[model samples]
Target chain A: MILPEKTIERLSKYRRVLINLNFQQKDYIYSHELANLIHITPEQVRRDMMLIGHSGTLRRGYEVKQLIEKINSIIDGNTVQYVTLVGVGNLGRAMLNYLKNKNKYLQIIACFDNDQDKINKMCCGIPCYSINEAEEQIKKLNINIAILTVPTNVANEVADILIKAGIKGLLNFTTMPLKVPSNVYLEEYDMITSLEKVAYFTQFIE
Target chain B: MILPEKTIERLSKYRRVLINLNFQQKDYIYSHELANLIHITPEQVRRDMMLIGHSGTLRRGYEVKQLIEKINSIIDGNTVQYVTLVGVGNLGRAMLNYLKNKNKYLQIIACFDNDQDKINKMCCGIPCYSINEAEEQIKKLNINIAILTVPTNVANEVADILIKAGIKGLLNFTTMPLKVPSNVYLEEYDMITSLEKVAYFTQFIE
Candidate 1:
């Protein structure tokens, strides 16, 4: 069954919190406790767990490891997903550094940039190719997902190139509104909008 | 009136889209058009507009300039908000570059880092200070919001210091779950979870 976008986002958050709990050696967690960690309501947590066909007794709560395995099967399955990063600027570099070996399922296999000096160089052990080579290299590497960090002016053009090159998913960091085919998936991560949201809430907090 | 967090986020997105429309010299936009640009339902856009006490006629839709003014009043008032960054690492630096002069109401006034070599230097025209001087500078500068981009291990400790230093809002970039006082507002921006969400949708897209 297809889940709502909001539900998928919450499931991802729950999985992260569960992994952290496992690392902390916490084997069991109540819905309310997990909700508190992620700043959501207990009922919301319970509803999400139910949607995924998982349940816990009111007394025992959830098993962290088992919940994680269930979520992994739903979100990632058995195969690992290979991702590529476009635009090796500051944001791109930061993402590469932060995500290096961080996840076993999702890995950034290669990167693309327009800078002549950066092309053919290795960033965080991931090969960097020129934007001109993005299409050829993406196909050769069998990359399915792309993280777009290009400037706003070039975002749409770069998105077009990636989509045409058979990119199934795009995690957009640029502010531009990109038009992709219905078959392609797009997720925009706008930092300024996010910060402004925080600012709005901070002012009206009761 | 206390608006829901989701409403605030949508408001932020609407404001951004309006700004882009204004840039394109578009005076009026229908809710459906705005929703199409942002990938949301028209009803959601109309609901957000209603929450902000703004409405449009069926003929002209919403006046782009008037809607922008209304949102500005709701999200940001007459005075600009002063923000500071806590880490000058790759993520922080990229954010600084992306946000420089982007918003007139919100400005990143200063930055803090523990790196001795980075202290006393300038990044994007913003002065960098040692983490030890964070409290002193934050208090003196009247900085209420902080962007925490430090490593996971040090995120909590630095957050504690910032909260004790009188920071009312935090835009956390680290992966660790931080516990702040009830009075303090916190927004966590985890890129990995966001990427995973994209991955999930890309795999399940029907």
Candidate 2:
């Protein structure tokens, strides 16, 4: 069953919240309680839960562990997905360090960079290869997804290479608006845009 | 004018694209051309421009420079907004380096960290202070905005302090769900959720 993009996003968020609950040894969670934790309405939470075909009893609410498994099955296919990181610049390196081994299923196996000095070096124990070797390394490692942190000038050019190398999805960090093939999924983490959003809203307060 | 959130986001995107066009020595741009660059519908672009009280001519479209100035006037208030970065960890340091002087309107003037060793040291020429001094420093510097890059466990605690420090807005990078007062604007940059979205979409490709 194909789910809407918004639903998928919420499912991921729900899984995170459930994991935290599980860590705290919480066995069950009411829809409204979970909604409050994530700052969403109870109706939206119920709607998302229904989309995953999981219904909670009125008394027991949602079984934390079981709900996590259900959401994982829908989103992660219950398997580990290997990802690659391109560009080991400041932002890229920061992401590499922060994301290392954080998730059980989603792992960044290798990284690619154009800097000859960084090539053949390991960043946070992940092997760094030259951009020239990105295609070969991706295929060898079976990498289908990539996080792009290169500069804006070379973002699209490098994206072209990644797409041609058979990457199925991209998490873009550069400011450039990348044009990927329709078959490839693209998610942008535009920091400037987000910061500006905060700036725009803060103006109304004062 | 109380523009919608989505329109504000689009306006930020439009400003970036227009800046790039201006850098390339292009003066005017049609709505369709701008939409194509940002991968949005021409109608959406037109609607956003209308919200900001700007319009394009039939022949010359919109003057790129004028549009940028108009958007900046609305979003940035034609003056610089001072911001602070909390937690000078790897992510915080990278953000400090990446955002330093990138915008004339937005500046990260001070940073806060709990580490006593890092306090009183200069990072990227910005002074680092102990987390205990955040509130006083925030008021002293007249900073109303902050970027929270602290660990997940301490995210909410630090955020609470920031809110109490009179921070009007925050760009949250931690995975933890933060609870702030209604008057405090919060924007979360959840990288894990974003990566999972890519992972979910990549499943359908194969």
Candidate 3:
């Protein structure tokens, strides 16, 4: 069953928190505690858990490891998903540094750039290929999801190339809102817009 | 008047696009054209414009420069909003790089970090101060909003310091979800959650 987009985002967050709790040797977490950590209502957490067909006992709450495994099974399925990065700029390298070796099921296998010096090198241990070779490299590496960190002027151009290369999902880092095919899933992480939103809210704080 | 959060985000986007169009010597934009550029429905764009109390002619559409000025007056008011960036690491540096000289109204005037090497230096032309100096520097700089790019382990600790120093809003980039006081506005930009969300959607793409 498909979950709402907001629900999917929250599940990913829940899994992150659960993995951390598991690392601390914590076995179970109450919906209230989890909700508090994520800054959401306890009722929202319970509803999400119910949506995923998980229930918690009043005594033990929810099993942390079991919930993580369930989320992994649902979100990631069985095999690892090969992903790619489309730019090797400072932002791109920062993303690679943060993402590399972080997840078992989602892996950034390759990166592409138009810069000659960066091409054919390893950025944060992932291979960097020339943008000219993106279509072939993406197909050969079986990459479906891509992280786009290119300049705004070339963002749509690069996105077009990625879509043409059969990329099904994109995480866009540029401020330019992109247009994609209906089948292609796009997530725009515009720092400027986010910053401005914060700026707007600051005015209300007395 | 306080606009919806989503509407504020869209206004910021419209302003960005309009600024570009104005720079290109374009004077007016129809709702459909603006919506197409931003990947939104024309009705939604028109509705937002209406909410902002702006109108356009059928023949000329909305005047680009006038709408931008109106958005600026509403979103930013008269004074520039000073912002502080904590954690001068890769992500922090990248943010400074992107935001410097980008906007006249929103300025990242300072950055804070625990690293001695990073402190007491200029990062992307902004002053880098020690975490020990966060409270003083923030207050002295009149910073009301902070962009947090610190490690997950210390995210909450640093957030407390920022809030205590009188920050009214926070844009969090760490993977750990943060809990802030009710008066504080928090925006979490979790790359892991976003990546995983894209990963989930990729499964449905044929």
Candidate 4:
């Protein structure tokens, strides 16, 4: 089943909500209640839930455990992805430290950057390589995913190199757009635009 | 004109691309070439450009200056947002220390954490506050946006208090989903998901 882009985005939010419920020892949840928690219409919650192949019984609502497993299966939790972080700047390095043993399902295996002083080193046990050695290292270590936090100027250049080295997807931290093949999945994150949205929407007529 | 969610996301990317181009002293850009750089169809880029009311001549493409002004206008460049980074963890504090401040558009107003020793202190002129005083201080300062880098466990509770105190948006760093009112916008970022996408598309299936 092909979920829409919007649906996939919501799955993470739903998964987080379920995790919170699990922590709270809540066993079941209803569409309306979950919707209220997420600030969406109850009908919308039901629709999102339906896409994951589960729903609440009128009285029983959605079983928290069952729903989590269902979402997990759809979300492919079994695979622990071998990931790499490039750039190792403040944002990239922070990401490197954050990913250190954070998730059981995905792990950062290596770090690469152009900074000569930081090159040929290790960040949190993940080896760091200079950009000159990136392709060789990525290919040698069999890294499939890359988190790009390089400056916007070099985003595409790094991405193209990664793609050439057989990277499957890119998580872009720079505010630049990347040119990748259709086979490649890309997610662009801009921290500034997010701050800007809050600023503009403060007294938004809409 | 209401663009698709996908397009709105792309605009941020385009603005970043244009900024980099401007920095490189590039004067003009063609839609096709720009599309080629970003891995999108020229037609799609042209359509998005149209949404911003920007026009580029056939060979000349779009005037870089003209396009940038239009983008800034559409994105509302009038208000400079002041962001509060809650929790001076690796992610939060690094962002405070590293992100370029010359722009002065999105300013880090203050930072808060649970540590007592760091309270009422300043990191780069931004005050640090105790978590106990967060709600009151947030309200007192009239902070409109918050960057949450606290632990996943306390993410929800902190965000709940923030929403109640009239926070309009959140740049969440924790791996938790925050339940907020409909009027509030929460951008949930998962570093692991960024890696998983690269793995699933690149290798797991094969």
Against the hidden reference, what TM-scores do the models get? 0.84, 0.95, 0.96, 0.81
Stretches of candidate 2 exceeding 4 Å from the true structure: A21-24, B21-24
For residues A1-206, what per-residue lDDT tens digits would candidate 3 score against the true structure?
A: 77889999999889887776454388788999999888899999999999999988999899888888888888898679999988889888988888777788899999999999988888889899999999999999999999999988899999999999999999999888999999999998888888889989889889
Writing each residue's lDDT as its tens digit, candidate 4 over A1-206 gives 55665665566567766675562377888887777765578888888887777868999688887777776665555666677888988888888888767555566888888888788878657788888887888888877778898877788788898888877768888777666787777777776665555544543522
Ordering by lDDT: 3, 2, 1, 4
lDDT per residue, candidate 1, A88-125, as tens digits? Answer: 88878888887767667888999999998889999878
DockQ of each: 0.47, 0.70, 0.73, 0.42
User: Which runs of model 4 end up more than 4 angstroms from their true locations?
Assistant: A1-7, A23-63, A203-206, B1-11, B33-62, B73-76, B98-102, B132-142, B163-166, B182-186, B197-205
lDDT of 4 at A66: 79
- For B107-188, candidate 2 gives per-residue lDDT tens digits of 8889999888899999878999989998999999999999999987788889999998999999999887788888999999
Give the winner by DockQ.
3
Q: Write model 2 residue lDDT over A1-206, tens digit each, in one string.
A: 88998898888888887776553388888999889977899999999988888989999898888888898898889898889999999999999998778777888999999898899999878999999988888888888999999988789999999988889999999988888888999999788888988988988876
How do the residues B1-206 of candidate 1 rate in per-residue lDDT, one tens digit apiece?
A: 97788887777778787776463388888999999877789999999888878999999899888888888888887568889988888888878887767778888999999999889999768999999998999999988889998977788899999998989889998876688998999988788877887788788654
In the range B1-206, model 3's lDDT, one tens digit per residue, is 78899999999999887775444378788999999888899999999989999999999889888888899998888679999889888778887787777778888889999898888989888988999988898899899999999988889999999999999999999888888899999998899999999999889889
Off by over 4 Å in 3: A21-24, B21-24
Q: Model 3 chain B — which ten-residue stretch has the worst lDDT?
A: B17-26
Residue range with the least summed lDDT across 10 consecutive positions in model 1 chain A:
A17-26
C-alpha lDDT of all candidate models, in order: 0.85, 0.88, 0.89, 0.72
Per-model i-RMS in Å? 2.8, 1.5, 1.3, 3.6
